[model samples]
Target: MHYKEAKHILSASNGMNLYRGCTHGCIYCDSRSTCYQFDHPFEDVEVKVNAPELLEDALCRKRNRCMIGTGSMCDPYLPIEKTELLTRRCLKMINRYDFGVSLLTKSDLVLRDLDLLQSINARSKAVVCTTLTTLGEELSRIVEPNVATTRRRAEMLKTVHEAGVHTGVWLCPILPFLNDTEENLRGLLDYCFDAGVEMIMNFGMGVTLRDGDRQYFYRKLDEHFPGMKERYIRAFGDSYQCASPNSAELMKIFQAECRAHGVRYEPDDCFAWLSEYEDKQVAAQISLF
Candidate 1:
């Protein structure tokens, strides 16, 4: 890991990435796509050392408070974060400004900040979002080797929900000919439902592959699932969106389960809800009759 002084932290939409590049080793990371143009190796994480200071400045200048988001381009809880504590410092700033927060990650290390998350939720919204693509431990290890397994993430979600903080799941990047079966979809949905997640965001039942991402993914496939690379080449042939053949059936099950559980499933709806800030302290005061 190396430190870089960032000119700014938050984006126009209030999203920020405290770091660039990742060590989670998810074979299908879209961030690895050539469109991102990384100057360093994917594992050589670039830390924005001034993220907390920049975020505090931005929040202090804001005329109106809104949700501060992170983990779009990189996971805030990357292993380096165990010592760097950049994400925690930024969360402190968000809490200090009374702004809401919504962050996404596949690491259970997020549990370390439950105190800050619960404190923010008491005054404003704080949503912890994670990705769940499969339930099989072995398969999860093969795909997202360096990150927390699916079961562990589910437990983390439940813990966060029990802390009175909202939790959401991103069920996506379902690799074709891999964990694209109906059973895999149902099992993951069961985990979300059991955790009582507020939403489950899913774009489709397939993964997108670009020049940088596709090559790395295919290489991993060749290493683990022999002959799988050839199969993908024959099936996809340079296509970007590699929709699984089971997409239709999985969609049906996904829709049915989400409706039955009353969880938000639409991407637009979830995004809107994540960005919407709520003042729970005022609501509590109003409830006092």
Candidate 2:
């Protein structure tokens, strides 16, 4: 890990990445794509030492309160966060300013900030999004090695929901030959249903592979799923969108399950919900006058 002073924090859409890389080591991480242009190794996380300060300044200057987002590119609750507390400081800033927050991570360490999330939710809204790629722990270990297992992430979602904070799931980057099966889809969907998630954002039962990300993923495949890299190379041949053969069937089941459970499955709708800000304190704050 290394610390660097950041010139700014929030993006135009009100999103921020407290850190510039990840430690979770998900084999299929798109952030590893050469497009991002990382000067160091992906594992060598770059911490934005001034994230919280910049966030506070940004929030203070905002004319209208909006959701503060993180963990889209790098997990905010990385292992270093246990001691660094950068994510915690940012959450405290969001809560103090009574702004909503929407964060996505594969680490259950998010639970540590439940109090601040709940506080933000009390005045506005806090949306916690978690990813579930495979159902079994063994597969999770092989694919998302350093992160929490699927069951643990499911448990985290349940706990977050029980805390009265809105929760969502990203069931994505489903490795074609590895986890793109009916059983895997059904099992993961059951976990989402059980957790009472408001939405499950799944573009499709497929994965995208580009230069930097493709090479790393293929190497991991050779190490664990022997010969899988060759299979992908033959089937994909430098194609960015690697759609699974079972994508159609899996997507059918996904849509059916979401409809039956009344969960939001549309990507646009889910994105809208994440960006939407609700001010629960407005009424009470107005009453004070």
Write the residue-wise lDDT of candidate 2 on 47-135 in tens digits.
89998999999999999999989989999899999999999999999999889999999999999999999999999999999999998
Provide TM-scores for the models: 0.98, 0.97
Model 1: number of clashes? 0
The root-mean-square deviation over C-alpha atoms between each candidate and the true structure, in angstroms, is 1.1, 1.5
Candidate 1 lDDT tens digits, 1-289: 8889999988899999999999999999999998999999989999999989999889999999899899888999999999999999999999998999999999999999999999999899999999998789999999999999899999999999999999999999898999999889889998999998999999999999989999999999999999999999898899999999889998999999999999999999999999999987788989996
- In model 2, the worst 10-residue window by lDDT is 278-287
- The 0-to-1 C-alpha lDDT of every candidate, in the order given, reads 0.94, 0.94
Clashes of 2: 0
Distance from true location, Cα of 152 in model 2, Å: 0.6
